[model samples]
Target: MEISNMDPPTRAGAVETTPLLEGDGKRSVQAVDVVPMKFRDMPVAAESIRKAFEDDPLMEYFDAADTAPFPVSRRKLIDMVDWMGAMHQERMLTVEGGMSLMKYGPPGNQTNLPSVAFLRDSLGRLRPEECAKRWKEFGAKARELVSAAFGEKVADMMEIQVLATDPDAQGRGYASALVKYVLRQGDADGRDVWLLTTSAYGFYEHFGFVTVRSGKVGEDNPAWDGEPITLRIMHRTARASLAQASSEPKSPVMYTV
Candidate 1:
C-alpha cells in the first residue's frame, strides 16, 4: 500500500511512540497504554510479531511448512518486515496493514504440496515439548507488544499478527481492553470488525463477532482458508455498530478457499 502526504513529525505534534515498556519495578505485571506503531518501528514490532506466532501451538504446525521446503518459504515471506514496516509509516495505510497484512499471517504451515507429509515424517526424531518450549518467551512478548500497538485493528480482517498482553498481565483486562478498543475503532471508521481466530473464537463472539464459513465469506484471505488449522473468521454482526453494509452477498458460503 502506498501513501502520500503526511503530517510531518514534530515534537509536540508527533505521535510519541514508545513500545509499551512492559513489567513494573518488580518485573511483574504492569499497567499499560496503547499507541500507534510507526512504519520504521515495525522491525521492532516484527521482531516481537515473529515471536508471537512462534509461540503459538497451531502456528508451529504452520511454521514447519513455512520453513520446510525450497519454494513457498522463499518468495512470499521474504522481506515482509520491510514491506510491512514501510506501510506503517502512514497512519491510514497501517490500519489496513494492521488488519490484513500484519496482525495475523505467515502461519508456519504452507503445505499445498508435500510439506505436511514431511512434517509427519520428521516428528518422530524430535521432541515437541522441548522444541516448542524454546520460543515461548519471545512469542509471549511478541503477543503483548503487537497487541498493544495494533490497539484497535485486531478485530478486523481475520488473521493477522497482534500482541494482546504481557505474560504477567493476562486477566487484568488487557486482552479485553485491547479487543474493545479495536472494536471501537471499527465503529469509528465505519468498517466491519474482523478476526481470524484459533484461540479466541467464542471470546470474540461474546462481543458480537459472528463467525463466517470460508465458502460463504472471504476466500482471498489465507487465514480464512483454514488451510492447516480451522481458521475461524468473525466479523461484526449486522447489529454491531461497526457492521459493514455491502451490496455483495455477505454470506460466508460465497467465499472461496
Candidate 2:
C-alpha cells in the first residue's frame, strides 16, 4: 500500500517498508510503511488495538463482569484504549496492520506521566466497576513483577507497553516489522528493552527477548472460569550502538533485554 499522508506526520525520514503477504504466504505486490504515530491517528489506531485485543485472555478477564450489550462494551473498550493511546501517542509507532506503544523511563522518560491512581480512576469511569478493580490488581502485580525482574535498571529501560495487530491482518509480518523497528531504536540508544506478555512467547523469542520471570494472574476470580493467564516478563539486553557495531568485526550476538 502506498504511504498515506491522510494518517498523520511521522518522524522525519524514518519510514521503513515491508511487504504485505497473501493467503498463500507469498509476498503481495503491495507494501506498507511502519511510521511513528501522531495524535491524529488516535481514533483509527485505538480501534485497531481494541479489535486486536478483543478476545485476549487478560482483556476478557477485565470485561468478564460486564453485562452491557456487545456494542456498548466494544465502544467502552475502544474509549479506554483511546485514552491510553492519547496519553502516550508520542511514544507510539504504527503500520497498516499493527501498532506498538512504548515508554522510556529515567534519562529519556516523558515528563508528567499519569499516576496509577489517576489511570485507575479513568478506567473506572470507562469500564465496569468490577473490570476497573481487576485492572487495578493486575496492574499492581505487573509492576511488582517488572520491578523484581529488572531492579533499578527497570527505570532506565525502553518498555514495549502495548503491541497489537488487527485479527484480520495477522501473519502478514506487520508485528515483526514493528518489533524490529523498536529493536533498532534500542540498539541505536544502547538501551535495554522489555515487555510483559501473556502470549506470543515464541514470537518475541525470535527477536531476542528472554523470559526473566513468569506469573499467573486472575486466579480464582469470580468472573473468570478459564485457567489463570500466564504472564511472562521478557527482557532484551541492549546491543552495541549502531556506530560501534559498524566499526567492530561482525559476530553473532543474541540480543536480550
Candidate 3:
C-alpha cells in the first residue's frame, strides 16, 4: 500500500495519536484516514499509485520502455489515473492523503467503452509509443483471461484495481481499510468482488478472497517483453458468508483527513 499518514512519533515531545484497530490476534498498526477520491485528489492519487506499483512486475514491464528520469513518469501516471478515476468515481475510488485505490462496480454496471477515448488520448499524449502499444495490446487479453478463469456468472463482480499506501504509512491499516470498505459494500449488496494481484496474494487472503487462477504472461503477450510476470485472479463471494462471520468484531472505520 502507498503512504498516507505516518506513524505517530515515538520520540520525546510527540503528540498522542489514536490507535486504529483492535480485535482478536490481528496485526496491530496505526490507522490512516480514507475517503472517496475527489477531482481535487487526482494528482496525489496518481502519484501514490505510481509509487505503489513501482516494484510490481507488470507495472515495471509496462514502464520498461520509459525514458523518464524516474523509474516511472509521474505525468503519465496522473493522466492515466485521471482517465480511470473519472470512470469509477466515488463508488470504487478511495484515498488517504498519500494512499489511494481504484476499483470498479459489478460487471455490466457500466460500460468501459466510453472511457477508451480518454485512455487513448491520455496515453497518446503522455506515454511512450512502446508503452502505449503494450497497454492497449495487453488490456483485452487480460480481460479475456479473467473471464475464462471465473466464468461469466461469477466474473461479473467488482474489481480492486490499484491499492497503494505510501511507504511511510506502511504497517498502518490503510490498505486493509480500503479493501474492507469495498468488500463490505459488496457483501451488503450481495455481489461478489474480484481482484488481480502479483505478489500480494497472501495479503488479500486475509480478507477472505480465494484464488481462482494464477499464471504467467505468455511469451506472445505484449507485456511479456523479456520480463517474467505473473498474476492471481481472486474472488470474495457476497456477504452471506461474510455476514455469518460478522459475529467476529469489525475493523474500525478509517477516517477522512
For TM-score, the strongest prediction is: 3
lDDT of 1 by residue, 1-257 (tens): 00111111000000111222236611123443444445554343333334334444345443443333442223223323334432333221122122211232211211112442333334322324432342232233333432433344543322222433323333444444345455665556554544444445545544565555322112233433344333444566333343233222333321223
User: What's the distance in Å from true for residue 192, model 3?
Assistant: 0.8
Clashing pairs in 2: 1-31, 235-257, 236-256, 236-257, 237-256, 237-257
C-alpha RMSD between model 2 and the true structure: 9.2
On the 0 to 100 scale, the lDDT of residue 166 in model 3 is 50
Residue-wise C-alpha lDDT for candidate 2, range 116-183, written one tens digit per residue: 33553454555566766676667666666666676766656776655766666666667666666777
- Error (Å) of candidate 3 at residue 63 is 1.4
Q: Report backbone clashes per prediction.
A: 31, 6, 6
Q: What is the C-alpha lDDT profile of model 3 across 1-257, one tens digit per residue?
A: 10111111000010101223457655465544667666666666566655565566666666676554553455445445444544454444555643555444454443333455455455455566776665554454455546566555644567665566555555566777777777877787777887666667667666666667655553465544575566566767777654464354333221111
User: Which order, best to worst by TM-score?
Assistant: 3, 2, 1
Alpha-carbon runs more than 4 Å astray in model 1: 1-32, 39-44, 55-57, 66-169, 214-228, 238-257
Best by lDDT: 2
